[model samples]
Target: MKKITTPLKEKDIRALKAGEEVLLKGVIYTARDQAHKRLCDLIKKRRQLPFALKNQIIYYCGPTPAPPGKIIGSCGPTTSSRMDKFTIPLLKNGLKGMIGKGKRSAEIISAIKKYKAIYFLAPAGAGAYLSKFVKKKELISWPELGTEAIFRLEVEDFPLIVGIDIKGRSIYDKR
Candidate 1:
């Protein structure tokens, strides 16, 4: 498995291939559907985003509240396609990578290639297991959104599979 850190660089993203396993480290932000909408709104209004999109990664998740004595709770990837409507703007805004579950749409695949970005698939139905990898967590914005709020997490050796690479290769494609 390839081991990498964030914020992801163009070189690192380019070096990955569809279906490759990876161990991701460093910071990643969690954002679910609602948070994604808000972010897209920010981008559309030409307002500053809560975090830099350039060379950064967003994980599609709405983590449960941290349990006592644990740094985090069930935190795993949500479906990737749910965010498709908002993806292009983020890519254009310089988002380097995304970590989520499931396949992406054709348009998103094309956008990923056009923008030189990447999509990684985190293990689904493994939130409790994945939480162990989170070393730290901090709310980034919209606390009212609860679990759907954006959060910055510091993770170590988080496992993922390359769902789509910059070259337009998709794991969902026929062999």
Candidate 2:
């Protein structure tokens, strides 16, 4: 498996292929459905975002509250397709990568190729297990939205698979 860090570089993204295993490290931002909508809305109005999208990776997740002494809790990936409508706008704005579960639409695949981006698949039903990789968590925005709020997480060697590569290749396409 290839080991990679955050704010993914073009060389790193291009070297990856669909179905390849990866260990991702560094910072990733969490943004669920609500956060996505908010971000897209901001893009529409040409307003400044809470964070810049350039070369950034957004994980589709809404982590549960941390218990006793953990950095995070049940931090699993959400379905990627739900954000399909909001995705292209972010990609257009320079978002480079995404981590989530399940397949993406054909248009999204086409867009991924056009924008030179990649999509990663995290383990499903492994929320509790995945929490072990999160080293730190800081609220980024919309705390009132609770779990759906945006969060910045520092991770180390978090496991993932390339669900869709920059060439528009997809593991789901095999079926």
Candidate 3:
């Protein structure tokens, strides 16, 4: 098992072997389907995105709204396969990491290897528990997309397991 700390370094991710478990800490961005589409369009036209992509982590989820006095609502990993199509292009633009649940497509796996990126899996069906780790949330873009809006989440000691590595290896498939 490996430990992945915040301001996540590519060396740590690249050193991770297939089937290794990892605990991740630090901030991660949130983007759902609609936001992803808009991001792709922005990338295509060479427009600036709300956040810089370098050395960042993008979590694929659309969390429930927070209740009073809470930093965030039920936060959990969404299915990752939905974001597969957007993965390659985003990776090309400096996206180094992803967090989500379930398997991604072949093309995405290929992109990960090409881009030297990593994918982590957060616990599924544990939204409320995960919400505790989020300290704050900022809507970054595509607010008109409703829950599908992109959010920049500030987290601390966010739990995670290494799902896929830059070498096109996956933990889930080995199991």
On lDDT, the stronger of 2 and 3 is 2
Q: What is the C-alpha lDDT profile of model 1 across 1-175, one tens digit per residue?
A: 7899998888998899999999999999999899999999999899999998888999999998998999999998999899999999999998989999998899999999999999999999999999999999999999999999999999999999999999999998985
Inter-residue clash pairs, candidate 1:
none
lDDT, model 3, position 35:
83
> lDDT of each prediction vs. the true structure?
0.94, 0.95, 0.84
| Span of 10 residues, lowest total lDDT, candidate 3 | 1-10
Q: Which structure is stronger by TM-score: 1 or 3? A: 1
Best of the two (1, 3) by lDDT: 1
Best by TM-score: 2
Off by over 4 Å in 2: none
Clash totals for all candidate models: 0, 0, 0
* TM-score, cand. 3 vs. native: 0.93
TM agreement with the true structure for every prediction: 0.98, 0.99, 0.93
For TM-score, candidate 2 versus 3, the one ahead is 2
Query: For residues 1-175, what per-residue lDDT tens digits would candidate 2 score against the true structure?
Result: 6899988999999999999999999989999899999999999999999999999999999988999888899999999999999999999999999999999999999999999999999998799999999999999999999999999999999999999999999998879
